[model samples]
Target: MRSHEHAAIGALCGALAVTLLARGRSFLEKLALWTYGLLLSVFIDLDHFVIARAKTGSWSYLTRAVRHPVWAFTEQESVFPDVEMKLDRLASHVLIGGGLVLALRPLSRLLAVFSAVVVYAHVLADLLREIEVA
Candidate 1:
């Protein structure tokens, strides 16, 4: 997909996220929805069997997990050498997750802020993928 196409999809996802938030759902519910979407996206990526796609999907999953306090304690391990290599490339994820957890007033607020960040990250990753694939 083109960068613009990926960005468009990101925007659409963002809109759906906002709509879910607007419908009187609790912040936890919104966070759950974001987490589920991200995980589902990863499952889709797994079907493609591309390293770049898998990396992007993994980052998306980590970002979502970082947003939810309940998921912060969870540890994800990969047996694949390439996937394990990418897992080690997560210094920024650690820093961002720490900062978000400290800065937000409540766990829900952290999730809300992180949801926006995750959406942007997905778009950027998609743009990078477009450039590489082109």
Candidate 2:
């Protein structure tokens, strides 16, 4: 799936979560949660550069992204047509997300649970994308 697709799914899932779990929250709070979820889902793909570098032992992909920040940021799927998709990095993404939830747990249990829910939504979107790609 493309970046836009990920953003779409993330937005949908985030909104659903806010509606269900944040039923009594203010509109602004719900919006903030939705935004947080959307950002996590979309920006999670930024780790592809590290994965690509590790696998190919080259920085060409990173360089391309750096040189074409706008294209890389907006049309990421098309920006690296020569490079292989980094779908294999899902485990690391999930692991990092779990750590985030654990780290946030001490600060606020509600926030930690909310973060977990959003990350799960992100994982679900990625899983569906992987299945579709396969």
Candidate 3:
């Protein structure tokens, strides 16, 4: 996708986050949710970078750190650490997603009461695939 599209999507995400925070949730809850998203985004980006670098023969800083002798040696034992980590990641995502949805539920209901059509439009737009033309 183009940078502009990414920016627009990011803006929409930020607005949705802000709206949820402002309307039905406490500032701390909003902050925590936002932080969760921030961390999730970082992880997603890290994974993306890793995959991209693997494809193109480049390295991200974090990947490089993992390649360093100390870190690589430390991580060598973990081929697969059971299902606990996977379950934990799944639980965290579900909790964050559900929390955000619940926080916005009141606002969404109120919007529906007022007949607003744009309530979940951002989310729909976000889910739509971006087809980039070469």
Which candidate should be chosen as best, given TM-score against the real structure?
2
Clashing pairs in 1: none
Against the true structure, what is every candidate's RMSD? 14.6, 2.3, 11.8
Superposed Cα deviation of residue 44, candidate 1 (Å): 23
Q: Judge candidate 1 against the unseen true structure and give its global Cα lDDT, from 0 to 1.
A: 0.46
lDDT of 2: 0.78
Number of colliding residue pairs in each model: 0, 0, 0
Query: Mind giving the per-residue lDDT tens digits that candidate 3 earns over 10-99?
Result: 445544665654467778855554444434333322233344354456664446556674753355324222212333333343454456
The positional error of residue 87 in candidate 1, measured at the CA in angstroms, is: 6.8
| Candidate order, TM-score descending | 2, 3, 1
The residue ranges of model 3 lying beyond 4 angstroms of the native Cα positions read 1-12, 49-62, 65-130
TM-score of 2: 0.81
Error of 1 at 38 (Å): 16
Instruction: List per-prediction Cα lDDT, in the order shown.
Output: 0.46, 0.78, 0.41
lDDT pick, better of 2 and 3: 2
Measured by C-alpha RMSD in angstroms, how accurate is candidate 1?
14.6
Compare the candidates by lDDT and give the number of the best one: 2
